[model samples]
Target: MIFELQNDYIELFKLIKVLDLVDSGGDAKKLVVEGLVKRNGEIELKKRAKIVSGDVIEIAEVRIEVKG
Candidate 1:
């Protein structure tokens, strides 16, 4: 899936929440804390990591490509 950026960036957890990947922000944060989320193929633990255009985020089987 592709997520179009409307600003300079979006927070990792917020992105997951906005995309409806999880039930709530807390769940998204939990996923990140558990190392279940990846940013550019590396496990991302920062829930508030800035996700900019061209960043690729993966969670389980869902892959989201950020586009400018």
Candidate 2:
């Protein structure tokens, strides 16, 4: 999936929500806390990690690319 940025960057959890990966921000947070989210292939635990254009996010069997 591709995510077009509306700002300079987006938070990790917000990105998940924007993509409809989870039902709510709290669900996104829980997923992250469980080490279910990956940033550029590495486990990402920070819910507010700044996701910029060109970054890749992976969750479950889905992959998302952030585009400018």
Candidate 3:
């Protein structure tokens, strides 16, 4: 299902923290450390990796598409 996004493009892992997708930044960090975040169908663990337009981020059953 579509997870409505409030940010068009964000740092790969900051998306998790800023969106409140996780409990806190620490939790978001943990999610990345545990390899739970995916970018464009591949597991991405970089917290500062730039995630630009057309990127797909998935966590559990949530899918967020970055659009300009």
Candidate 4:
């Protein structure tokens, strides 16, 4: 999947919610809190980690590529 970036960066949880990966923003944060998300192939624990264009996020079987 691909996510077009509209700004310099996007928060991790916000991206999850924007993509409808979870039912709610809280759910999206929980997904990250539990170490269920990966950024650039490594476990990402920060829900507000800055996600910039060209970044790759992975959750479960979903892979989202950030494109400018």
Residues 1-68, model 4: lDDT tens digits: 99999999999999999999889999999999999999999999999999999899999999999999
Give TM-scores for every candidate, taking all chains together and pairing residue i with residue i. 0.98, 0.96, 0.80, 0.98
Number of the candidate with higher lDDT, 1 or 3: 1
Which prediction has more favorable lDDT, 2 or 3?
2
**For model 1, how does the per-residue alpha-carbon lDDT over 1-68 read when each residue is reduced to its tens digit?**
99999999999999999999989999999999999999999999999999999999999999999999
Tell me each candidate's RMSD, in Å, in order. Answer: 0.4, 0.6, 2.6, 0.4
User: Residue 59 of candidate 1: its Cα lDDT?
Assistant: 97
Tell me how far the alpha carbon of residue 16 in candidate 4 is from the true structure, in angstroms, after superposition.
0.1
Which pairs of residues collide in model 4? Answer: none
Stretches off by above 4 angstroms in model 4 are: none
Single out the weakest 10-residue window by summed lDDT for candidate 2. 14-23
Q: Which stretches of candidate 2 lie over 4 Å from their true place?
A: none
In model 1, the Cα lDDT at residue 7 comes to 99
Decoy 2 TM-score against native: 0.96
State the weakest 10-residue window (summed lDDT) of model 1. Answer: 20-29
